[model samples]
Target: MINGISIYEILTLTTILFFIGVYGFFTRKNLITILMSIELILNASAINFVIINTYLYPENLQGAIFSVFIIAVAAAETALAVAIIINLYKMITSVEVKGTELMKY
Candidate 1:
């Protein structure tokens, strides 16, 4: 246990966050909402990495390093995704998933 919270409890929270992110990703139509859900999913995984690493290897910082890397990658991914979404929205005037299908040509 860390900070008075058991590993099971922490893992449970991460699981809930992961599922919420997954649900949002599948059900949301707007590009921005989908992007947010992706971020949530990424964040949950990062937290899981940190917590599990800390619990299993109290002396090692591998999990912390990985979480940092994940965050950096996620930021870059978000920047690129937002740019693409913005261009798509400009061309179609809609950010819905169906609207992007018109760009398939």
Candidate 2:
């Protein structure tokens, strides 16, 4: 174990979580599920960023600040996306991935 936590262990865990998010994003057809997957991916990224920052610059707190901002933005995005999805569902009676594609035009 390095630094009381093996580097390999941390990397492996992060990789697994990232791939799980990717799989969810690709396999899930519902808009909400896709949103959740996106959130998962964002979380994984934040985790990796924090770990790297802590390892490389233990004295600086910039990474924590950035992570907080990321969380705020992700929360806002999820709120807005959920509202839009609800509206779309009300109009189409469904929240499937392709159901809202017509809104593009």
Candidate 3:
């Protein structure tokens, strides 16, 4: 129910969400949290793309298609991340930050 809110407001909100995601990705130490933050950033970009396309070019559906692709990619990314996290947890029994440092050469 945002009355009189212009397209700029929507873009601003998207930018804020994107920055929040960037902050979370930078600040979080846990792997899962980082992955979630990445997803958030992706979602923010997708939303902004869709909104811009819908408002500026109402005839084209390319933005919607791109958003769908983003969703699919996000789903695949989450699945892979979960699998990796589970394997890491099984190996160490703890999914804490710096747990994978041992893998570094």
Candidate 4:
């Protein structure tokens, strides 16, 4: 437990967040929503990494380092995904996943 918050509680929160992201990914038809869901999933994992590392090996920085890397990658991914979604919107006038099929030859 860290600061009176049990690791199980934190892990449970991460699990819920991850499942919400999964549910959103499956149910949302909009590309932007899908991207946001992906971000949520990434964030949950990053949080899990940091929390577990802090609890299991307080002296080691590997968990925190990996979490930072995950955040950086997620930022780049969001930027690239947003750019793609914008271009797709311009071409199809919609950001729905079904609209992307029109781009295929």
Global lDDT of each candidate: 0.92, 0.84, 0.87, 0.92
Assess candidate 3 and give its TM-score to the true structure.
Answer: 0.90
Candidate 1 stretches with Cα past 4 Å from truth are: 103-105
Q: Encode model 3's per-residue lDDT on 12-79: one tens digit a residue.
A: 99999999999999899888888889988999989987888877777888988899899999999899
User: Weakest 10 consecutive residues, lDDT, candidate 1?
Assistant: 96-105
Which stretches of model 3 miss by more than 4 angstroms?
1-3, 103-105
- In what order do the candidates fall by TM-score, top score first? 4, 1, 3, 2
Model 1 per-residue lDDT tens digits across residues 1-105: 468888899999999999999999999989999999999999999999999988877788889899999999999999999999989878889889988674565
All candidates: CA RMSD in angstroms? Answer: 1.9, 2.6, 2.0, 2.0
On residues 2-103, what C-alpha lDDT tens digit does candidate 2 reach at each position?
A: 468955677678878889999999999899999999998888877776776677677888887888888999999999999999998899999998785766
- Per-residue lDDT of 2-70 in model 4, one digit per residue for the tens? 588888999999999999999999999999899999999999999999999988888889999999999
TM-score of each: 0.91, 0.83, 0.90, 0.92
Error of 2 at 79 (Å): 0.6
Ten residues in sequence with the least summed lDDT for candidate 2: 1-10
Give the CA lDDT, 0 to 100, for residue 44 in model 4: 99
**Candidate 2 wrong stretches, greater than 4 Å:** 1-3, 101-105
Better of 2 and 4 by TM-score: 4
Overall local distance difference test of candidate 4? 0.92
